[model samples]
Target: MLKAKVGGALPAANEAMMQRAEAAIGDLRQNFKAWLEEEVGKLEALMRTARTSGIEGEAGEALFTCAHDLRGLGSTYEFPIITRIAASLSKLIETPEQRAAAPVALVDAHVGAIRAAILQNVRNDTDPIGKALAEELETRVTKLVGERS
Candidate 1:
């Protein structure tokens, strides 16, 4: 039986490709701050709309979507603390029933924290203040939402 070629020249080519990929990612990193800011701005707009319309309708759903997107994008944007806080916010309003009962102040706090992190350059949990804020928000959200799946 004939076996497939193992790891010869392919490994070298793969290594070169990996290096190129890393360089591309590094290039993209420069734009991450602006991208993250745009996302946060959208989230803030959604928050305002949610406040005006109440959390039981379309605006609330949009707010949840914005938070979910921020949760997924935060780490990619070099803001892992944002990911943590956004995750907690996502959990707190994941469902309509939860949104109906979710405190506007709590949602406002999460958004405010995200804005503060950006403004203060607190990108991750390594920062003491960022860590404390993320932990507190997560704790509060868990108490209300009973942990997210």
Candidate 2:
């Protein structure tokens, strides 16, 4: 009984293609995570500065848009940390009372905690895009805080 031995399970070429596809998907995930982390850093810094000095003019508008964008992205990606942080931020400005009472120190501490969580607990498939972005945002945040003060 000449059982034509065709290769196991997947044909070699098909297996190779599938492997490539998986690798491509992995690459895509890495890129997306990198992008999201950069975005988060930017949002955190903006929040920090706005909280510290009180946002104003075009910057205030930009900050609000940034918060809104982060919430939408966070919701889409199912990043619980991002979603919660963004929700807290949005609530701070949701109503007049909330906005008037929200404290700069509170926002800074909460966001600082979240940033640490992301840096320590969250693992992105890519390299340290988050690290680079965090550093850049850190510098900008310091400068903004100083300016506001």
Candidate 3:
């Protein structure tokens, strides 16, 4: 008697599923720009709060959360450059202790870069300008906090 594989579907089935998934993603892509803009607005508002309340208490924690969210969502929004920059920002203030020590200017710069990346349609590191800005921000963050452990 013949037996099927225990753990997976046939290649043809997998390919069909992948095609469907791609179509779904294509449909979602139409909304990605608006979604990305909304997320950036949230980040900006959080940054404003951080400006007044400082980066140690609720405002700082919220800022980090927003940055973390943006880092995760950036590529989904077709803006991998935002992901890189937001990742840097998230690393700079992931913990309360780090937030307390984090420089306001660095935080603001990261936010600004993410905003600019979206506004300028710099979607990924392929753009030399976006790549350079992301790398510079990452370098500064590493200098202050070292690499992620």
lDDT of each: 0.91, 0.55, 0.92
Better of 2 and 3 by lDDT: 3
TM-score of each: 0.87, 0.51, 0.90
**Which regions of candidate 2 are displaced past 4 Å?**
1-27, 56-58, 95-97, 122-149
- Of the pair 1 and 3, which is ahead by TM-score? 3
Using lDDT, give the best candidate's number. 3
Please provide, for model 1 over 1-149, each residue's C-alpha lDDT reduced to its tens digit, 9 standing for 90 to 100: 12345534333357788899988888999899899999999999999888888888999999999999999999988899999999999999999999998999999999999999999999999999999999998888888879555
After the best TM-score superposition of candidate 1, give how far the Cα of residue 30 lies from its true spot, in angstroms: 2.3
lDDT of 1 at 134: 91
- The digit string of per-residue lDDT tens for model 2 on 1-149 reads 23346434543467788899878766666566667777777867787677656754344455556766766776445355555555455544444444455555654654664466466653321326434534444444344333221
What TM-score does structure 3 among the candidates reach?
A: 0.90
- Which of 1 and 2 is ahead in lDDT? 1
lDDT of 1: 0.91
Residue 116 error, candidate 3, Å: 0.4
TM-score of 2: 0.51
**Candidate 1 residue 112 C-alpha distance from true site, Å:** 0.3
